[model samples]
Target: MTTQNLLVELFVEELPPKALKKLGEAFAGALADQLRAQGLASEDSLVTAYASPRRLAAHVSHVWLKAADKAVQQKLMPVSVGLNTEGQATPALLKKLAALGADVSDPAAAVAALKRAPDGKAEALFYDSLVTGATLDTGLQKALDEAIRLLPIPKLMSYQLESDCELPGWSSVHFVRPAHGLVALHGSTVVPLKALGLTAGRSTQGHRFEAAVSPVVIEHADHYAETLARDGAVIAGFEARRAEIVSQLAEAAARLGGGVRAIEDEALLDEVTALVERPNVLVCEFEPQFLEVPQECLILTMKANQKYFPLLDAQGRLTHRFLVVSNIRPEDASAVVGGNERVVRPRLADAKFFFDQDRKKTLASRVEGLSRVVYHNKLGSQGERVERVRAIARAIAQPLGGEALAQAADTAAQLAKSDLLTDMVGEFPELQGIMGGYYARHDGLSEDIAFAIEDHYRPRFAGDALPRSAAGVVVALADKLETLVGMFGIGNLPSGDKDPFALRRHALGVIRMLIEKDLPLELDGLLAGAWPVFGERVVDAHTALADFIYDRLAGALREQGYSAQEVDAVLALRPQRLGQVARLLAAVRAFAALPESPALAAANKRIANILRKAGEVDPHVNPQLLQEPAEQNLYQAMQRFVPEANAQFEAGDYTASLQTLAALRGAVDAFFDDVMVNAEQLDLRLNRQGLLKSLHEAMNRVADLSRLAA
Candidate 1:
């Protein structure tokens, strides 16, 4: 077998750097898939990708030459027809010959040719074959042709050339940018590649800026990447712009007085990657006064205006200077620094204005302004949303200590959206909740409530943080409920990856508040109560959003490494009690690792098994219904155990709960060992089931202990 290297390079007009990065991996994976589908990829086949803003390329090495030959046979359809009474060929049957493009007079030969002569190859000699040409090497052109068809380059266009070669439109792949051309070659020789109608070649180009226009002539496909690398391109295969930015940032930070503190900004990195060819860092300073205007606003300015990485001091505090990454190096360096600083000035100045104006207006006064601002096109305005949230806060407050929590939540919600209308948040929209916290404090809200104002947006990203205080948790839940309800009312819930309303975030936030904050607020009741105040105009707003937030609970738990099976088991019993599910999950996880805990798990498993058969159990399972001695014994044991299991679960002492629940194993096992559930007497069977139900019911109060896996 001859070893061969295959290379295909798509040279296009400047491509979006971020797009190129993702597209690169997609290209490689797609090509490998096409090879498998075509029966070409083999044991040694592997695909590698390389991308730059101007081009995306992939190389397939040691790929199988072509689909292996297989013996072929075709089955002929059986035809049976008869004439009326006389058993002769009828006119209808005779006329069918013409429809089949055959004549009755000459059909014998055609029929005979399709007949199988034997069970094996003896049959092949008899049947005529419809053969497709096969080659040893799959080569490169068709692979590229498949890539072009499946690549799905966003904002794609068509590239038509008058080489007089014929191909279908879908196969004649074009892109958003002009493809300077594609070079498809196997082992440096032009392979017989055809689909998009181009054969393999030995030539490629270097970096658009770094290398000369003269193509980097290649000797072999194996050397294609190295050739380009020698021409000042690193083609190990990823986004060059991002790689360069990270590399240059690290180098630059090491040279600075301290490390370049990385501020979290993936979105900014994506946007800026497209704006550069090569990334270089330049440290620039802003006025110290700008730091006072909220680090969030200043950082956003640094990222938005300058595409810079913000720096942090030794104390993890935002410094006055930021590191701006430019695509091209400047000769007069000071000019670039001045230009970025000038551009960011307006953004920071706007922050200062929002702070001052908001300071002048009491946080309490902002409540009235909320009513004036529209919350949704159909769900009234900010004023209406505040009203709904105030109601929700009260609904949730009862579990969190009704009146005090309610007041705090109501105050926070009243002032929450005020910052949205302020100059700073309007300029830096991400500062909406942050500005609210600032004004809430100035207006005399207690520290807890003011922090709640800011923290309502807590954990904007997964694993960020849960609301820190009871008030903050309530308001966060209220805010998320409003967003989910408002958006869902308008039919804007997340479907797959298309969450236009950020409903996933709202739901995750709600779940975080429920579990981490341990708010015992019921989702359905809260939404139902808030609907009259907020959901009157929206369609199916109550249940729709309740179910949506519930779904997010599963997702949040899954992210923490919970199994789908475990989630299903817990959710099956108490779907809405997200905090309860979390608590039970901990107990089960701890119990599983305990060597002595299996007997307890076995007992719970027996309880769950019995509960499943005795379906639709009442929570008020009658202990008095117990007729058997075992039934009476189990009821007393469960009565004694419920509080302890509930206490362990409540305190998050899962290990303790496992011990407490396991303690009931002896009584549970004894009851099952000695008892019969479906006795001949009706009252006794129901009583036995009621006894088992009591055990299941008590354990489920903290968790469906029966749901615990052995």
Candidate 2:
């Protein structure tokens, strides 16, 4: 029953910075999960994960030294197989008992003790026993092995361990990195286990150069982080190290004193945190001439290539000075700052050179080079894709703004991918559309056209801003639709988590543009226009592509706080004008919350069923056939309310339209309750069906209210 806090650490060579956070979380989560599954750790146990550039560790509280004993019931063979006709134990039963490590001295007595339970049509014999709990040593070993096997390693490093760590011969081991040490502590005692050719010990190596002690001694399980920080001079926890770096970056940026701040990028911060153990943010600078080149180029080079955070001024302009997260905090610190500055100058110069050289050739001149660059083997060259995109863009633009916008969109789409041929775009592919815009401006093109080229790739990810100009909107929509239709046409749709082409993102981009821009374009018309651009290269994937877009839209609406029922009610119609979907959903939600919503929703569901079963009945209510008082009352209600609701619907007042129908709830409910829909007379039955059909049509204008029924 004794329990103790446990600590585990795997020290290794530097890990891939981008993947370190995931690796750390997965390692800690898998280890703790395995321990809990084995009953060695309780649900109340707390797990703290620590990860640095060189280590991944987990400290778990209240881990028992041994798991609790578990009761197990195992079904044996049928009674007929285990016992003879005379109710005596058979040889097979004795063999089975012997195999189970049970006493088989008297088979009859053993069989008599077995429980009888009915399994299907036959009675079966069952054996129950207490399973001894696993010892901590064995459980920890299994958990460690599983955790290591499950680490989200970006790439595995294979190496031979030192002879002393394993056998005398060169023993090959593959891991995220070559393991230098493994520390496993249960309280103050060392837990006997081995991983990656290293035995468990209290000593683990810390910061390579700044450690107070080369081999940090973790005195106890709970003392891991504090001890490492004090003796090893390393911030062992990933979040702790990141917070320290962020604080240091802010402090350093403040010293510059011109409303300057380090550029904020979570991914960049995480990567930099994973690159250093003891972060010491120091100020560094480059020549102001480098700033003359596009700030994006300088920023990208500094952050992506050098892992530096560029300081930005009050006007959002990149400052010459940047912050570097140095691993060692030397007293003077001059050498570290100078070294980083020197290292970064060449990277900046390269970017500037690429930018300058790229400007010499206009985007128009480079358009021909895209033919040499293949976009996709099956989809043809970038040149061909550009032509297709231009065709789609022009088609989209004509309806929105006549020939002026169409020409602008066509011009932008033609030059959008032309930047791919530029040296700057080749050096930094992230700046493709951006450099295209810059070069378009340099070519003396109109600002609108240049902006359209630049903004064509807007809203690349979720929550990103859409294109600002009419031309940009047209080009952006065309670009995304082409990717969606082309990819879906080839049957390369996203399955589960595997979307190589990012078709889901493209679909979402199209949906956002249509809905957010409130562009009068219909989804079916958009797809019909995009499909022909591919000609025979693509199959008729219009229907499939539209469905995929709707699926993404449904998910997006649900994420925006609509319940599944509410979203289903609205999206069930597959509304063509996605711009109105938000309005439709709002109306549906408003209608569902009303006092009369439940009754009306149920009646609408009943009416739908009745109409479906009636098989294509006209909604024209023949008043002469309305004999019952309930049917006649419903007829009068429809005549009085239907036209007003239709007027509200035509005026774009969906909420008012749906709310207006709530008045007929009484008549609708009474009609369903009192009238016989299937009367003996054919004319009466048809009339009743027609009245219900009319009600169904009016109730579902905004959404399929029946889908909201419980």
Candidate 3:
């Protein structure tokens, strides 16, 4: 099993910058995984993924030139079927032997050599053979094909390449981009293969304009990255290139001498890194007058449209100076700096024009235009959706805040979607809520209303921040609830990771807000309020929606480090106040750690099963019916501690409440050990069932202890 590090590179036109990181990782991972599965690479083989604007590559350490030979025993037909009663080979066995490349001239001899093994209920004949190892050339070809097939390509480009054959022809090829070359090396020797109409070679093209030498030759499998860097003028690794860009941005910003720093956006940084090979961070500036526009608007245009990093000052305001990642670094870099500055000026001017034009028509005036904008074909227009959201917002606001907050929320919800009609938002749909906030302020609205308008879409994704203002929280809740209830009601529920409307995200957002904000709002009541807003347009499926939200909440809690049993215990009750779920989970954890938790949890499970079997058992206990000592002792324990636990529960001390029950573990064990819950005497049986019912209720006030049962 002689081994050498392997390197494979696919050179193409510039990849989709945003998708490059994922594509590169998928390519390398799929290649390594397939190789390992085929026994061409060991489990500990290290894989280094390389991705740049023009290429995706991988360097796998300790890959075998040929997979180890394996001994295999393949099952044939049953012994009875393979051999006749005379112990001679039958026609079926002779045919099978021929197919297996065994000599069938002597059928009896062939049948005698076959081994017998039990397969299911019958003894079956088996063929024992050794499978030859796969050569590196063949295995690498299969791996290369598999890796290309598995790339997470954002989009595919279909193109034709000019054939180099004597017979003139054009070959059609489809890939993430038009792949010009491929490099596959095993210790400096090119692995003979073909992919995407190109033959494997040791040479690959580098940065289109900055390569020190054209068609840089990779000297060895281990030297692929270094050779490309020195001669091809490319940084081959995605993370390495990103880190370099970060360092350059910092250094370039420091030279400006204003306590300025590049805005921290890892996604933006990655995209910029993928857009350049040899990144030359240059400080470029625009006219300071453009600062009058919203910094968010300017910064977004710069990053999204131009792929530039906007610098921020100490005050957290946008600075005129920004950093550009130039692919080529020429002496006296003034031309590159000037070109980027000149290109950004027009983009900034467009954003400024949109901002100024958008402000001309106050958000209040844009309300009527929203009716023409469709939110959903079945849910009606944006105007109707706004009304539904406004209604839900006001209903939510009454409990979150007083009439003042209600008014603010109503205003914000009504105008939140109006920005869709604005030029600025139309140009950049990502700035929908953002531009609305600006317009609200321009209309001389209160700060609370403006902030609420912007923050209503808070927590757009996982781990995103929630709304800042009370009014914003109310509106955000309303908006999310409206979507959930409406979508669920319409029977357009999410199915298997296909949430076209991002309903999962909305559900998680609601859960995060309720749990993190510790809002006093009940989940049922909120759904009840949001449903009527849809009026006759939707069915009453709020129960299903509640279940959906709770499911999301349970998963989120588990992700936050709670065990499945802990989550199940707390969520079993369907506690109306979602804010209390965290406390319930904490209480469950503390109770689980108790020394007596296992016994108590098991007892609780038994009690639940018994109760479920005994239909409609009253919890009212008659002390005189407790003839057994174990029952009497458990009754006395309950009488003493049930009140204490209840009191703690009422006082919101859930941990204390669950902890007080730990003292009753011994009595519970004794009762279950000695007492007959289903005695022959009806009175005794009913009374005993009643006693267990009382115990069940008290133990499960915070969470269903039975669910924690093993």
- Most accurate candidate by lDDT: 3
Question: lDDT tens digits, residues 1-710, model 2?
Answer: 78999999999989898999999999999999999999999899999999999999999999998898999988879999988999888888888878888888877679877999999999998998889998899999999999999988878888986666344677789998888889999999999999888899999988898889878999899999999999999999999999999899999989889899999999999999999999999999999999889888888988889999999999999989999999998899999988998999999899888888988888899889889989888789999999999999999999999999999999999999998888888889999798888899999999999889999998878888888888998999889888888888888889889999999998888889889888898899888888887978879978888788899999999999999999999889889899999999989999998999999988888888877787898988889889889889988998999899999998989999989999998988888789999999998888788788878888888899999999
* lDDT preference between candidates 1 and 2, better one: 2
TM for every model, in the order presented, reads 0.77, 0.96, 0.96
Task: Give Cα distance to truth, residue 453, candidate 2, Å.
Answer: 0.9
lDDT of 3 by residue, 285-305 (tens): 999999999999899999998
TM-score of 3: 0.96
Query: What is the overall TM-score of model 1 with all chains considered together?
Result: 0.77
Clashes of each: 10, 0, 0
lDDT by candidate, in order shown: 0.67, 0.90, 0.91
Cα deviation of 15, candidate 1, in Å = 1.1
Error of 2 at 156 (Å): 2.5
Error of 3 at 639 (Å): 1.5
When summed lDDT is taken over every stretch of 10 residues in candidate 3, the lowest stretch is 104-113
